[model samples]
Target: MTLRRLMTACVIAAGIAGSASMVASPARAQSAMEAEIIGFHQLCEKGDRKACIRFGILIGRNEQRNADWRRAHADWFWFER
Candidate 1:
């Protein structure tokens, strides 16, 4: 594959790796998925720019979810009043 195509595939795979834990059922399944994510994350740490960018996107997504949940729960208090 060309460089552009390779980067796109790696980015897509990184996203899937990020979400793998969410849908994983068994402990073994989760372990395997987590290992895949770790591998990607390690690549990011090693200065692979594309991998680093994808990893940052994954982390940002998690933070966004946490912020959304916190906002929703905080709003619950107002709803009760």
Candidate 2:
């Protein structure tokens, strides 16, 4: 009800909103990355040697990124063998 209280509440609300946006930003970036990875995947499947290398580098480090890499690997064993 007081001006001081109102300003404190506003600051809290702004902090919460800012944090939520920060959390959301990574998900957006990840989806964009996934899209790029998918495009590379398609290219790799179609016999683009350079694309295959790029795809592996982008999604071959950890288990999370490796999920896509595994799928692509299975689908493109011809290239591997």
Candidate 3:
């Protein structure tokens, strides 16, 4: 009975940890993507044409319905040429 209780506790702990990690995963990915986008924007500002294009493409692909997205769209169009 004691061993069974221990096993059940371990399973519950594992499940909680797994679910917590799953919840955090998307936030981490989004932050990472935002960091990449910021890096690309910085590079573009410093006259890296390739970075400008890449930044534009990344922002365009995301397609956020926000001012930032609109600004990025303009930047992309300006740098696309």
The number of the candidate with the highest TM-score is: 3
Number of clashing pairs, model 1?
Answer: 0
lDDT (Cα atoms) of all candidates against the true structure? 0.64, 0.78, 0.77
Off by over 4 Å in 2: 1-30, 68-81
Ten residues in sequence with the least summed lDDT for candidate 3: 63-72
TM-score for each predicted model, relative to the true structure = 0.34, 0.44, 0.45
Number of clashing residue pairs, candidate 2: 0
- Give the least accurate 10-residue stretch of model 1, judged by summed lDDT: 72-81
Clashing residue pairs for model 2 = none
Give RMSD (Å) of candidate 1 vs. truth. Answer: 19.9
lDDT of 1 at 61: 66
Clashing pairs in 3: none
* Per-residue accuracy of model 1 over 1-81 as CA lDDT, tens digit each: 599999999999999987896677554544563455456678976889887776555545676644554465465225535
lDDT of 3 by residue, 31-78 (tens): 677788879988998999999988867876755633465665576456
- Collision pairs in model 1: none
Residue 77, model 2: lDDT of 43
Please provide, for model 2 over 1-81, each residue's C-alpha lDDT reduced to its tens digit, 9 standing for 90 to 100.
699999999999999999998887764344787788889989987999999999878876667657655675576445655
Once model 3 is optimally superposed onto the true structure by TM-score, how far is the C-alpha of residue 12 displaced, in angstroms?
A: 34
- For each candidate, C-alpha RMSD in Å? 19.9, 6.9, 7.2
Report RMSD for candidate 2: 6.9
